[model samples]
Target chain A: MTIPVSITVNGRRYDREVEPRLLLVHFIRDVLGLTGTKVGCDTSQCGSCTILLDGVSAKACTCLAVQADGASVTTIEGLAGDSELHPLQESFWNKHGLQCGYCTPGMILASHELLRCNADPSAEEIRHGLEGNMCRCTGYQNIVRAVRDAAETMQGGTS
Target chain B: MFAPQFDYYRASSVAEAAALLEQHPDSKVLAGGHSLIPVLKLRLAAPSALIDIGRIDGIRGIREEAGRIVIGALTTHAEIAASATLQSGATALSEAAGMIGDPAVRNRGTIGGNVAHADPASDLPAVLRCLGAEFSIAGSSGTRTVDAADFFEGLMTTAVEEHEILTSISLPSGSGGQGSAYAKFSHPASRYAVIGAAASVAVADGVCSAASVALGGLVPAPVRAEAVEDALVGKALSAGAIADAARCVGDSLDDDEVLGDVYASAEYRSAVAHVWVGRALTAAAARCG
Candidate 1:
């Protein structure tokens, strides 16, 4: 059976009918064509499918599309404005946070959620916050640095 | 991997969710979906209906009431890890929550879902058991409470009936200089506990008045080391005494009961269990002192 789902993504509303078995990741990637949200491990082990669900980062792969009906979601593509990049996006690029860029979107989204609630997270706090997201390349040092750099910029500090 | 076809219902309230579950025998409650979705994707579980309770109100908060900490079933691990109340009153729980399946799983997974799933490898069950938490369940009949010890029946099994939905968990207020800690050796791949220990100690005048030790990922269900707890009472809160009591965890396990998988061996898990128990005991005792 198909269930009607109305979700707001990146400030735009999408109304559609979806299968109960369709994963939120699939819905975002295939239905909405927001392919920035990559699916790494279909299991919840990997953070590549991370997205902001109602302001909190969640694994899109584990969530059913029908579960997200009437909810608000934010993908990595939503992080940038028409002409400028989000501070975290800029920091990731400047700090060499991405090597393959496969995990970048998820990492960025997760970091966005972390920095939203915690503007000034300590190193340990940042590490703990990003534990759910995984990056095989760059050894995570640069990613941590990117988040720290972004946090500084968000606090109105010069980069 | 495509999940099997099923009817979906987004319940507006807990009562509606319970009614849906009661109406469909093959229906399953979808919380964080960290546990249920994987099984569905793997075709291990084929529920005919999925009642999504993620949208239900009043099932997602961490509150303190009447000297007890009440965590709603929908309270995510991130919420628990970030909760000041949990950090102050139930530090072990917060620590365990921080350690569950890395950051993404923690962000998406819920405490009630973890406890309801009743996986022996889950860190929350052992820690909550050590804290003497009570689980609240709601059904078509009514609501009922079950102690943590009684809530976990076996591997991947809980006291929750098929028609019942776990609503929340309540942890007792620590009193009389009580302190607690949780220690676990996680499998690097899955982050599930290879062997985990949660310890709570109540000290009075530099002596241990009472202690509870719970073990997980070493058996089919979380095990309370009653023998070790008995050995610690009246003993001076010292490192040596803690070590002795921790070592008694091995005696509580049967030769066939120790967990073994690709990540670890039975003997290794038993050894790690002893080490983790000692660490948890020492840390908890330090807090007590």
Candidate 2:
């Protein structure tokens, strides 16, 4: 059976009929064609499918498309504004937070949540907050640095 | 790694959820989808339908009411962790909730689903048992309340039947001279507990008046460390006294009941239980008065 779902992504609402068993991550990637959100681990353990569901960070791989009906989703594609990069993206780029870059989108989005809740987080707090997302490359030192830099930049401090 | 084909029904209210449960005998109530989704993906459980109650309105939040902390069913682990009332009153629960499966998992995993699924390694079951929490279950007929002692039956088992929906959980709010803590030896990769201990200590005039200690993760169900509790009830909660009491944790655990996996052997987990229990009691004692 298929269910009708209307999810607003990046402030644009898209209505579709998805198979009841189809995952929200698949719908965002396949149906919506927003491939910035990668599926890593497919299980909820890896946060590569992390997205903002109703302004809160959640694992999209764990959520079914039907479950996301009427919800507002913000994927990595939604991070930038017009031509400028989101402060998190800019910080990641400037800090060389990615070597393989597979975990960057989810890392950035999860960091965005941490910064949204906490305007200025310490290095340890950033590492702890981004524990959900995993990066096989960079050994997480630069990821921590990137999130720290993003927090500073987002908080009106020069980074 | 995808959930098998199953019909999805979004329930509007608790009453409707209960009705759906009655109608779809093979259906599972989907809350935050933390526990259930993983189970579904692993093909461990394939229900005919998934009644998505994640969006139910009135069944999510923590409320301080009449010396009790009442937590609605759909309250996420992150919500419980961030609950200022729970933080101040029910320290063990909030602390344990905060430590479950990192940040993103906590954001979406609900306490009700955690308890209902009753994963042996889950954190809340032990903490709830330590706090003497009560569970409210709604059925087609009416709602019934079950104490924490009676709620968890065994591994992956709970008192919630097929026709019932867990609605809320309640426990006494923290008071002066009383405190709680949860200590766990977590597996590195998955972060699931190897041995989780939750302790609640009540002290009066520099002496321990009461104590409730429970352990999970390595056992099939939350086992009460009654001997540990008895030893502490009349002691001064001294380091030596706490250590002595922590040793009694072995009395409550049977050799046959301990769980062994690739990460830790049964003997290893049994050996670690006393350590984590002692740590939990020490932390709880420090927080007490």
Candidate 3:
């Protein structure tokens, strides 16, 4: 049986009927065509499906669309508000933070939540914050640098 | 991987959830979806229906009532980790909460789901055992409460009946001259404890007056380290004293009962059990006022 689900993605509200088995990641990618959110492990092990649910980073692969029926979702496509590029997005590009780029979307979204809570997170804090999202390539040194740059820029250039 | 077809209901209240369970015989309570979703994806167990109680707002906050700290079942691990009350009053619980899975997992996993699913390696059971927390379960008949020791029956099994839902868990607020801590050797991949230990101590005049200790992750269910507790009751709680008492934790385990697999052997887990127990005791004793 299908049930009615109303969710606000990015800034627009979309209402649809979904199966109880449909995962939130599928709803974001398949139903809404927000394909930027990639599914990595599908078991919630690899944080490739991370999204902000009601302003908190959660593994979309591990949650059902119905579970988030009345909530708001923010995916990678929505990260850069009105700006042409969010600081994290720009730093990732300049620092060459992506090798395969498959893990980049989840990495950026997860890092966004971490930087939101802490504007001046140290290297260790950034590493610990993004532990859920995994990158096969890059070895995380440049990812850490990109997040550090974004944090400095967000805090008005402490660098 | 998609979960199998199942009817869904978003319960408005605890009573409604219980009633839904009664109406739908094979229905399951869906909380944070951290545990259940993974199981469903694996096709381990498929229920006919799912009663989504995630929106029942009344069962989702942490509060202090009288002298006890009451945590609604819907309270998430992130909330518990960030709670000032838990951080100051029940430091061990907060520490364990922070050590659970990575940040995103902590954000969505609820205490009730973790407790009800009752994975032996999960951290909260051991902390609850150390703190002597009580669980409140609601059913069609009414609400009933059980002690932590009795609430957990076995691995992935609990005292919550099929028709019931856990509403909240409560424990005495931290007392004077008391401190508690949880320590674990995390399995590098899964992050589940290889051998977890929780210690709560009361010190007075440079001597240990009372102590409660529980061990998890290595055993089938969380067990109280009574032998360790007995050895510390009258000791000075010095580094050496704590080590000597913590070693007695061996007496509480049967060599044949420890869990082992390709990740960690039973012998290895038994050998390091006291190391974590000692670390927990040392840290807990340091926090004692």
Candidate 4:
């Protein structure tokens, strides 16, 4: 059975008839062709498929398209504007936050949600916030530095 | 992995949900879809239909009523962790909620779904049992309440019948005076509790007047540490007394009930249950001010 769903992705609204079984991650990656949000572990453990569901960080792989119906979702692709990079992206780039880059998009989006909730989080809090998103290659030091730098940049300070 | 195909029904109200469940006996109620979706994707549970009750109105808030703190079933872990009222009155529950998975999982996982899922490794059930909470269930017949002790049946089983929906969980309002804490040793990878101990102690004039301890991950379901509770009550809230009580944390359980796996042997889980209960009780007692 297919369910009709209208979801606003990033800023644009996309209405589609999705099978009841189609996961939100697949809907965004396969159907919508927004591949910025990588699927790391298809299981719920890895947060590479993390996205902002209605402005809250959630695992897209664990959510169904039907469950996200009428909801607003923000993915890694939504972080940047037309020309400029989002503060998180810029800070990550400046700080060399990624090694393999597979976990960068998810790390950036997860950090975005973290900074939104807590604009000035301590190192421990940032680590706690990004617990869901795993980076196998970066060893997390640079990612933590990137998040700290992003927090500083987002708060009107230079890193 | 993708979820198996199933008919989806969005119920506008609890009655509608119950009716839908009645009509489709093989239907599963989808709340946040954090737990259900994963199971569905694994093809472990392929219900014929899904009754989506994620947007139900009355089952989604934290409020005080009749000297009891009532948390709607649909309240997500994020909501519970962020609830100031819960933090003040039910600190153990709030702390436990915060410890489940991570921010992303907490944002999407609901208390009702967690309690109903009854995963032995889940953190909330043990904390709820320690808090002496009660569940308000909605079914076709009528609404009924069940104590947390009776609500859990066995591995991934709950007292909630197939047709019933867990509407809300209520705890006594004066839970703050009875300070509580949840000490958990979880698996590093999945963050599921390897052994968690939730402790609550009502201190009167530096004496432990009442005590309750519940354990998860050491058994098939969350079990109350009755022996630990018995050892602590009416004793001085001292390190010695707590140490004595901690020894009885899981003493009542049979060896077969203490599960063993590659992560933790039954003996290891049993031993840590004592240590964790001790730490949780010490922390809880220290907060009783």
What DockQ do you compute for every candidate structure? 0.77, 0.85, 0.87, 0.88
Per-model TM values vs. the true structure: 0.96, 0.99, 0.98, 0.98
* Order of quality (DockQ): 4, 3, 2, 1
Please give the lDDT score for candidate 4.
0.90
Q: In candidate 3, what are the lDDT values of residues A1-159, reduced to their tens digit?
A: 999989999989999999999999999999999999999999877888999999989999999999999899999999886858889999999888899999999999899889877888999999999988899975899999999998988888854
Candidate 1 — which pairs collide? A131-B103, A132-B103, A132-B104
Instruction: Output the number of the DockQ-best candidate.
Output: 4
**DockQ value for model 3:** 0.87
| lDDT-superior candidate, 1 or 4 | 4
Docking class of 4: high
Where's the lowest-lDDT run of ten residues in candidate 1 chain A? A130-139
- Stretches of candidate 4 off by over 4 Å are none
Tens-digit lDDT string for candidate 4 (B1-289):
9777899999989999999999999999999987888888889999999999999988999999998899999999999999999888888999999999999899989999999999998999999988999999999999999999899989999999999999999988655458989999989999999998999999887689999899987788888889999999999989999999999876767788998889899988887778899999999998897
lDDT of 3 at B156: 90
Residue pairs clashing, model 3: none
Lowest summed lDDT across 10 adjacent residues in model 4 chain A is found at: A135-144
* Sliding window of 10 residues with minimal summed lDDT for model 3 chain B: B187-196
**Tens-digit lDDT string for candidate 1 (B1-289):** 8988999887888899999998999899999888899889999999999888987879899988999999999999988988988876888999899888866677678998888888888899999888999999999889999998899998999999999999999998676488889998888878898888999999988789999999998888888998889889999978899888888987788878777987788888887677999999998887873
Q: Number of backbone collisions per candidate, in order?
A: 3, 0, 0, 0
On lDDT, who's better, 2 or 4?
2
